[model samples]
Target: MASIEKHGPSWRVIWRYQGQKQRTTWATLDVAEEAKAIVEGYRGNRTAEQVYIDMGVLTPEVPVPTTPTYREWAEKWLGSKTRISPGSRARYKQQFRDHIFPTFGDTPIGDITTIAVGTWVNDLRAVMGSPKTVTRYYSAMFAPMKAAADQGIIPVNPCKATDFKRDQRADDDTGEHKAVYFTPHQFEQLRAAFPERWRVLLDTLVETGVRWGEVTALAKMHLVAPTKRTAARVRVWRAWKRGEGGQRYLGTTKGRAKRSLPIGRDLYDALAALVDGQPDDTLIFRRADGRELDYSDMYNDVWMPSLIAARRCATHPPAPRGEQLAGATGRCRDYGGTRDSGEPCGARVRPGTTRCPSHYGPARNAVSMCGCDGVLVIDQPASWHDLRHTCAAWLFSDPRMTPLMISRRLGHATLATTSDIYGDLMPDLEESAVDAIADARKSAQGTRGKGARRKR
Candidate 1:
């Protein structure tokens, strides 16, 4: 037991060690409280002299073994990791530098408490929008502390003691987000909106559900033409990856497993046209200069523009009966009008008002002659990864495709991975699962009836 009390113009922490009472006096109450904490923690198995040394009450005959700082231990832990990919290693380093180091870099590894680690995680969850992203950073921080524990540097890993259950929000909560993907109709409109040159790339992505890196790394040899006994397929064996040093190269697939996905005749023809007369080693999808397409450039320059154009066409269709349909009363509002080019005046205006003189009316029926006319439009936002989810959604909607089949098609590491993501989306699968148990019970009852009749 330890207690802190006031002495003459100072504070004293009194405790017992090795059956003898010990006391340490400090100039301030804070210092006395800190000494009290040290005394309380120095329980069984710790050397008798450690308490005195930790409180700076006694000088040692030899140098005391000091615990490494969080940064020092983290560097050693990261260096010892050799099995991870260069890209993964780079990401881990980035997570440490950006998220963990600022708060705990100089803190002694042994001194970091579970409460401190838990507080850091909560702060990150507040600052970062996504819980999954926060979890990744948490894992990066947890690994080093776990290694420190294994190496006898600390008594326990503080991170392991944290209860993450409290941090999780319900699916419908404001901060929580689920997978975002385009519906089939929306995808069709989006695909139609893309330029002719890049349409096949989008087709391949939606059909096979391969990752962006995996699709970009595809070569002519990876595509296999249909035969008498085989279906047209694409072999996914490798992917384009960047290392910690920022060098790009072909690397193993994310799961380090090779999967061959059967493709439709339409997609096969599209892919074959790209690889026609090219060497087997030639990339199936690349820039005209024979360079791999960068994600940032493609997203900004192509995907976004195409997506916006498609949404616009969906919202605004061609004028009814060749006469521009205006508003609910079939007439333009005070601030709405057409320009000299016969296009609607798209100038910005004040909300809920026709005050701007730049146009005839503030509101009008959407009227645009675009390729996506009469096509279902998608207003929801999406990203490149959503293409993969789109494929999964499509597969789940089809009765012919089972969950296991969808998992393999998406190149998921396990069926559980696929189910964890798209399981709730598959109402048919859930119904079938219920029916299977019902059918099994009926079959068992019938079998028992037959046995009883035979015995009779």
Candidate 2:
């Protein structure tokens, strides 16, 4: 039997098992009654431990271990992640260092309450300056705690109760990171801006939509049927990625999928010419000295200059006071003249052209002939990866191309990935579907009318 007694404002349940007395306190009489029932239920065959279990005070069959500090568990958790890529491991370590350790590292894992986690999340958002960054830090913190909970070191993951919204800005129409692409004509203009030696590389990028790592890893042996004018294909087997400490290494392509993409006649011819006389395993693209292409050098020295020259005019006037006075001295002799505001023209000029695009009429191969230096500045800034975006855009322009086709071409692991990234660029699928249904119905009605007339 069990008994209930009132101690001031609170209620207490009392009971005895064997020879020892047992008791528990509750804030309300209703809870006291429930506790009394649980105490009485264990009277016949069950023990006191069973009664505690029934009262929701003890978990059955499992022993609670000493709780480790958050830092101890996090370190152990990170060390056990042996399968993640080196780059990913480095990023995770950095997150632990910069975000996780400072606040909760030394605290006992069991002491991390939900309220504390929620407060810490708010602090992280304030310090990190963006919802996206806060979310990443939160994930890093949550992972270790979750592992601890799973292993029975903690009762529950406090992070699970913390609320944080995923940053949706990337997917919003006005997102700062929205994908931008160039038209074929614009691509040609950009290609022409590069020196003749580098144009083939640009062609491969725009045509194949392979990642930069895959492009850099392309070898002569990867090209199959190199002499075929229209049906040549490039096999993507591996990719080059820079590991931690800036060491370059070869690895599986993203999603670990190997795929082949067909090359156009122009690209095939270009590749055939480039690979002529080279060893089968030699890289198709390299520096002038035949060393492996350094991505940083390529972007800074080659890509940026070409992009600037292709998109802008040299409106920048010569140095005002120094040797830049037109024909006054050495390197400044060819500086373009003054701007409309009488300021020295600061716009960059084409290599051989005397004036910036603003002053010059048009380059021989200029696409729009608008002679507007503002175009490049106003358009979405281009990055190396945007070449992939350009390829997707061109593929989407064709009404016959499907998302699955684009996904295969891009070597993506799933159709959903392709659709999620490039769904906006796809032709109006709903409209096309409705139109096809209407056309089918119309054809059926015409066939029935003809049948009725024949019957008549």
Candidate 3:
């Protein structure tokens, strides 16, 4: 039974059903009277669903929606990912902010359809202008939705039906999806360009094939020498990586696998000179003022300038117009016919030339033709990681080296990775396999011929 009562200028509806009391306040007596009638009707024998529908709590054709919005679910999912590395967490947060939130944040998890998701993916690809970037953003968006579906919050994952392909231009730019590396001659030229103090660091990078983070984290204690006559080897257990806010910390290597690499005598001697009497934990390489080396600072101040200097053309003739070269800035080295003058030419040289237009011949029409004076001009610039690729290339060039040996040296997680990356460089192995098969067939034929003759 239900009743309406006036309580301090407001009308209240009170009801008793299923042995429980329920009450609600209304501003007017008329509204409270209507609610009291509806509650009184519920006193009769009826299903809970019929009562709920009569009270406008649920529609006859639709059940109550319990699905959370995308934003709510994403927050819950991100909070549960506590085991991820700090860097990865930072990246996920960034991806959510930059890509996922703007589009699907307010949408209900159940309401997100496959067609809507496909449109969103296409929009991201169009706006981001890179398929690789779109792929990453798509993955970030998919993770939370997939989790929702797996937990039964949603019936299906919309992302599971969409297909995204990486941009072909990206693969073409990065050496046809293969690792880009330096040749030995190019490495030597780059080596000579660096200051003597930093040469050992470059040597270590080329010889050891360790990652940039691992090499930067090297300590004196990590080097081991079994005997005085033997070359030392580096034990790689940890690496230094930048986390959120550019904070640096030591962590395990990429594959989470520790490895040891043998160092040549030259490298060992160089390292010994640097850390002879220092503490076992002292860094093997640092700035001139004893500060930790930052990759960006070193690249901008030293690497690019050195590379430019090493590739400058020395024999370029002076311009026909006798105008100063367009990009000239650095110190010139061409002395012309004044070698006996006992002074360097010391004039400002152009960017693509070793000397000013007056000293060197004319600036060549093509940049490739400019650096013909025994200097190698690299068409594509190489990053620090490319040094490791160069090491892999050299190892693959040797017929004696096997994939397992290269995989261990490069610290790859599996032989398949090494084979997939450097498989194109192993063309000779295919030829050898074919020859072996042919030889086996020829030997079987010869044996058959001999047996027939003996029977005869």
Candidate 4:
């Protein structure tokens, strides 16, 4: 015999199982109906209630997991009983807990859809999260769902190839220009603004575009002697933990890291001094006392504070606008202050415009230093890296270099990627005015020939 009754707002179904009353936690009336059918079927069959069989009338197609909840699967995806970086794994857990499972946690993987993900992204974006992050989290959060999809638990992965819109968080906060970085002169000014140790850090970053992690992972072993045909080199073979724990890894780059860069003689001297008398195992970058610095440790304790000390952020004036004082001459003006000074004294800034030309000098922001002297930098708006754009622009303009070769040297993954960044830097050699003038000259020559024939 079984008993059925109502409790609170929803109907509660109770029954006798092994001579004891049992209740179902069907939160809704619709759920209760399906649960009631399952109970009734079991009662009719006289089957024991302890059995763990697939049973759901309404969502019959979705076979019940022994326990259907996101919390169960997420733990498994965090790498069960394995040795991985704490930092990396924490992010995995955070993404699942914060983003994915909350929205679709209760829904069966079988019913997940592209539209569902799209809608969720829209809602999240409305709340002011960056679309780029949403996309990244989508990859990590759905690993289990991917497994479920493979087992026919779901039909498709809606997260792949998604169209994400850029977020306006930075714009909303400070109203900065969309692109920011140093020009050669500004970088020189900012670099000169830095202390010796911090000078090395900023100069390297402006030169290589290396991520903070790669800089920490750098070791004396990475540098090799130069050969006749090739220049001296340093390799980006490892990185400090990008994951949760402070574990160091042998290989992995974050956001444009892990590149083998040619160290010009000037940059090489700075690096060589840092790693002098150290074993191959010792890192190239270090604290003042020569201890290996973790990624965040360097950025917080040293990098940002150094910028503060140098007054880089404080001295920044508004960006330069329109045509700069320098024309096609390519001859730079005398702005004082070196990269190690951090003053706004000697930069080639156009007053009130956002342009800083030095950061993008000949080396592509690789080592865009200026030789100008005396003036202390007052204001800067662009970043130390936007100079890379300035440098990339120069490479594209020269007919002697192809975009492919330039992209390879720049460590861009593809020609298309390089083109996206620096394509417009190359002008159309088509020169309509030149062609029109040539046509006029040819017409004049023809008229002269006709006149001579008439005279003959």
Candidate 5:
């Protein structure tokens, strides 16, 4: 039995169990009444102590652990990732601060539901407008929640329960381009676009398929000069990486795996020339000042400029509507384009435009060609990683190179990873496979016919 009585500044709920009286205090009459009702409801079958625990008046013998908030648990999860690279740690921190924390930081891990995760993903897609970026951010957030579920802190991982595959299918239906890699001829044009000093760097990238970090971190010691009986080899053991505060440092390769890549004699000689007379520890590809190569400086100052120069597009000054204009050539007029120097934009404008595509705005085509030189315009831009893809593309073109061999050459973690990425680029290999099957079937049929004739 239970009852409530008004006390000074507080209300008291009283109950009797095992012939003893017990009481609990509440701040409000409503809470007091509710506590009384809870105790009364459970008094029939449950013991007094159990009723007291249900009423929030007493602690149970076995304490239940409190479920941590997403933020708290995520911090624990991050701390547990001792083996992740510095760059990965920085990226995870960024994702937590900028993306994950905003949505579910304060929510209890147990309270995070699949519907909530789906809604967050949809919101991220709408705001970010890049499914790939959304996926990257989501993966950072997913790992923590998954750990929570594994530890039974939550019933299940909401991130995993969310229908990401269905969303990906929807993205595919929207006709997103899956990959970008240049043909050998296109790669040559791009290589020729670079200056003589940086040409070997581009060649190395397209030839070996090493990552930007790996290529930039190359030292003289990594290169093995060509021998009469064996081809030249480059050891990929380290890479330049960013850590906390964006400080650059030498780090292990992406897979933490060391590999040796065979290079052509010409490429080997060129690489050797770059490091000639330098110390064994000196970077093969370095800045004019002998400092490490910075990606932003190289991309904006060198890579993009070279790409535009390769286009060799015709350019014209701004002309009034219906006015016939003579062609003009030179630097972009857009303000603050180069290093915020406030000078005219240095990026080359496409033919018939006053500003470069960056300032001129988006084009409405997958590819555009320069009317003058028939060069592919920069509408479908490629990144440094595309050079790695280009290497894979070239390797896949060779019938002698199996996916497993290509995987080893590319330093991919597994053959499946190689297939997943470059599968679409292997149409010729697929055709060869079909041709081999047909040839085998024909040989089998010929043998059967010969046996029949011998029996006859």
Candidate 6:
């Protein structure tokens, strides 16, 4: 039955919605009419209605285990990831500590929302972390949450919906860095500044473009003569990793790369010539204490001093250049140097790329060639990494090699990556691209002018 209630002399109709059997109240005729319209619109029947219930739906709070702090989980993940080659594992550990743990470590995973994750990443970028660095941090931070989601411990991953927005280059940038190459002149000045052994280290690194750790890990055993099944080559199997546990084991190659490098004429001759009289298993580069030289000490004592010396040379050095250390040269050695190995150069370390240990470093006193006081001489400033950059640059700068090939030569994961960093080096070609398009446009305009004249 419908009833009319008096409200300030205006009649209000009260009615039931579902059916006589099902009791659902509507305050007025208009309310009943609107509710009937909705039910009809939804289910094609005005009678269909469910009682609105606002009771309880609890969000699953992901349990943060009390015994294991965020630090413990991070450490465990690092420890598990240590199966990878030592260098990569060390980087993972560094990323977790420096970026991941501090912000979200104590927070329970279930409570972390996508918006919060995005905000944290934005904060990290504001603090000046590189895109690459943040990318790694993103992976480490979310991996556990993802696992928790899969295990039904959490409803969703906080990091699941977020995309790292900073990968696009800064609007002012062209996504390329300028070239910071080591001049031949600077190389010479640098050579004379360090010990004969260090000179060899620097020179060989430039010529071969092998990493510092690779050089440090090089033992006489790894550079063995070839057998019947394979050609003569040097194995790049091991590297000394500096980490919490001290020197950790590294290297089995990342993907398709063979752990050994082919020792062709340059490498074969220099290594053979340099190590001719020495024993087979000797460490190629070692410290005074007979321990492997820590990478930092190697740079601080050897490479950096060489750079300082280069600055002192007569010719002022160009300020630091490009993406790579910009001086890692490589391939092999043979000529110049004038050593007793019976070869032409004998690995005496003249100034070109291929170099051996004995004549490796530059003169300690800065000559006019480098831009510094000629008075001081000891070690030069140069890290093996800078030398690696130099080596890749050497390949990229050549006319014959394409950027794609260079990427492969340098063991980069993708071609676009190599081009992104070094695209500016090939300025002529980039300019040519714009010119080519402009020329085509002009040619088309000429054709259109001819057509209009014909019409006239």
Name the regions of candidate 1 deviating beyond 4 angstroms.
1-67, 149-156, 165-176, 314-376, 426-428, 452-456
For all predicted structures, in order, the TM-scores are 0.70, 0.65, 0.65, 0.54, 0.71, 0.55
Q: TM-score of model 5 relative to the true fold?
A: 0.71
Clashing pairs in 3: 316-361, 317-361, 317-362, 318-361, 318-362, 328-350
Q: Is candidate 2 or candidate 4 better by TM-score?
A: 2
Off by over 4 Å in 6: 1-82, 85-99, 108-111, 125-136, 142-179, 192-194, 224-233, 248-259, 262-267, 288-290, 313-382, 413-456
RMSD of each: 9.2, 10.7, 15.8, 18.0, 11.9, 17.0
Candidate 5 overall lDDT versus native: 0.76
Q: Compose the digit string of candidate 4's lDDT tens values, residues 1-456.
A: 344466777766566664656766556777666666666644422222332232332333464444334455556646663645666677777777787778877765544555676678777767645645655666675566666545554434445424532332323532222444344665566566566666776766666655556667788898876778988888876666644554555555542435677877778788888778878877787766777676556555654444443442333322322243333222223333234344543455444322346532222112212322423333343444454555565455566767776776566767776665554554543354577789999989888856455545
Candidate 3 global CA lDDT score: 0.73
By lDDT rank, best first, the candidates go 1, 5, 2, 3, 6, 4
**What does candidate 1's lDDT look like per residue over 192-263, in tens digits?**
889999999999998999999999999999988999998899999999889989989888888876799999
Candidate 3, residues 121-234, lDDT tens digits: the string is 878766876656776788888899999878977756878865544433333543344456788988998898788888988899898888888888888898887577665788
Off by over 4 Å in 3: 1-68, 109-118, 142-161, 166-179, 228-231, 317-368, 371-373, 414-456
Query: How much is 431 displaced in model 4, in angstroms?
Result: 12
- Predicted candidate 2 versus true structure: per-residue lDDT over 1-456, tens digit per residue: 788999989988877665677777778999889878765543322345655676787788777335778888888998998666676677778898887888888998876777778888878756765666776788888988999878877656888865554443323433233666887777877887899889888889989999998998888899887452457899999988657676888888988879988887778778877879998988888766776788788888888778867766556422222221242321212464456567777665534555655555533223333556433432555777889998999888888888789899999999987866776775576578899999999989888856454544
For 212-251, candidate 6 gives per-residue lDDT tens digits of 6677878777776766777667776666555555555554
| lDDT scores of the candidates, listed in order | 0.77, 0.74, 0.73, 0.56, 0.76, 0.57
| Per-residue lDDT of 80 in model 5 | 90
